[model samples]
Target: MSDELTAKLDRIPDPKTGKGLQAAGRLDGVAVRNGVATIVLKVEPDEAIDRLKADIESAAREVDEVDRVQIITTLQRPAGGGRDKAAPRQASAAAPRPARQIIAVAAGKGGVGKSTVAANLAAALAKAGQRVAVLDADIHGPSIPRLFGLRDIKGLRKTDTGIEPADAHGVRVVSMGFLTKPGQPVVWRGPMIQGAIQQFLNETYWGDPDVLIIDMPPGTGDAQLAIAQTVSIDGAVIACTPQDLALDDARKAIAMFEKTHTPILGLIENMSVFLCPHCGEPSEIFGHGGTRAEAEAIGVPFLGEIPLTIELRERSDTGRPVAFDDGPVADAFARAAMAMLDSAREARKPAPEIVFSS
Candidate 1:
């Protein structure tokens, strides 16, 4: 069993360095019992984990004697680096609301239009006959309410089992702003911030929806950590622009998610281009396709680019997301959403045959 499994594991290659697993000492463990093979791999964090796992399993199963194979993969983290352990993760919601998927939209820093992208993405998904819910996890600076032009909304309401979420433009909305006074600042400690996020996630009464989009706050902070331990996140979408400053932060955001072991759906290049109204000429305002290039470098898909336009801002500010109307900006968001849908489905694909059903 050992010799056969070793031969099989050594035949595979590392996705990043193009070196065989045996050469890199990545195939750390292999055992076979009762026709089942268990293999362990210690690879770099940036390596294509899903592809590598599938490849390793396929090779092991080809051994003829092995009936089933299980691959356990762990990232090779740098020395002195460990995962953030600030917040205590809550158990899965006891109620088990029927949300098919939850995708967190995050950025390295603020002002990257992360919230706007999440809002418009949810709007686009809803327009495509998907029941969508948008949770403004940006507790400190919640723009989800303002993005949908719900300026007058004071807060959410208490309910018998859970808190009720607001409905805006046919999308479910929930934010910390609903509980605080207008313009009031949320200057709390780490525990307070985590508590707020916990309530929003576990206590909200979100009906069955096809997708639940979380508009995460900028930077990797307590909120991000809280979400990591709270529930099982389906995937993440990193939002960034073409500017170097923004990309620098975007890299940090990506690293944080990697450390947390969350699958990244892809990166969205917001403000990819700017259109001049008078001359109808396009300008590389933020630099063209920087996010696409970054995505390729990081091995994630370049979902789509959203050109900078005033109509998007105006409609978003007026409680009408551009995705609600048919146009260029709306089409861009729809394309981006479609990319996510595809990536998510592929990522969540079930193994060839399941021994147990959930």
Candidate 2:
């Protein structure tokens, strides 16, 4: 089925080279599942992206088994070796920085609840009267849309200006989840991931916000490198558990940011304790203070600790983050949000340069 879909895409002509999309290297990926055909295309700035998308969608729908066609586009690098230079495409062509502070919420490994931390932080920032936007960079596991209770949003609004993100809880969000259907997996390579990040940064119409919280995919791999190299990330907030295993990965995350020259905003100790709802007593389920101690050892600021409460879990599951409501968990997240803002401001300060006689 996938091969048939690819064949259909190959027949679509690319106006630039007057060749097929596959021959021109424009068809990035093709997949067929449950009668739905998904096509990912690499489009250049000068190309008629909408026209090409429409053409592909129309062509794919001709297949008897394909009941629906979904098309996704990524920013294609200019021909003749332009990947390195492509990082600044958005900064040079797009309006300007989408927000004053572009902070990446990252973790060294998966299952660390990084997306939950990012969602609450964005909510807390918005609650504090700052305009916030979230970019879910975890293309394979995009949870921001569900975290914000935006699963109903099927697609983004594409205008002559750019793609408009979905709004929720007074915060704007952009995620790969919004493009693909539920339960659909994103099977892409490094270059494809890089292109998607570039497109989200450059082509999205994110009205000037105070902060853009990027929920990065776990690990120090291609996605992380793509984000670090593509734009001037003001700072990165590392999320880790209280266990030694999680801390080990967190250290690697910090090291990656340092190596990339992106500032370490701070570290967050998530699931620090479990507060029993019935007894109102605190239990160090994951063992407490490990992250704080690790932060002290590494000389990085320890933002704060987020407790594991029944309420916190319920709110997150229901798409209503605890950060918006007044509670202990909300207070903790607020404190972290403020600390992140401070770190971002400090990061923006220009380093003092010394001049010497030569």
Task: Using TM-score, give the best candidate's number.
Answer: 2
Instruction: Summarize candidate 2's per-residue lDDT along 13-92 as a digit string, tens digits.
Output: 88888888998998877777778777778876566677778889888988889988866676576567646532322345
- TM-score, model 1 to reference: 0.73
Cα RMSDs, all models: 19.5, 2.9
Model 1 misplaced regions, further than 4 Å: 1-90, 93-98, 350-358
Question: How accurate locally, in lDDT, is each candidate?
Answer: 0.82, 0.86
Model 1 residue 133 CA deviation in Å: 0.4
lDDT of 1 by residue, 1-358 (tens): 7687787777777665677787767865676756766676775634567777888888888877788775544335456756547433444455374377989999999988999999999999999999999989998898988888777887577779677889987898889877666787765556556656766877788887899999999999888987886677888999999998999999999988887778899999999898776676889988887899899998998889998888887887788889889988999999999999898888788879757867
Clashing pairs in 2: none
- Scored by lDDT, model 1 comes in at 0.82
Listed in order, each prediction's TM-score against the native is 0.73, 0.88
What does candidate 2 score on TM? 0.88
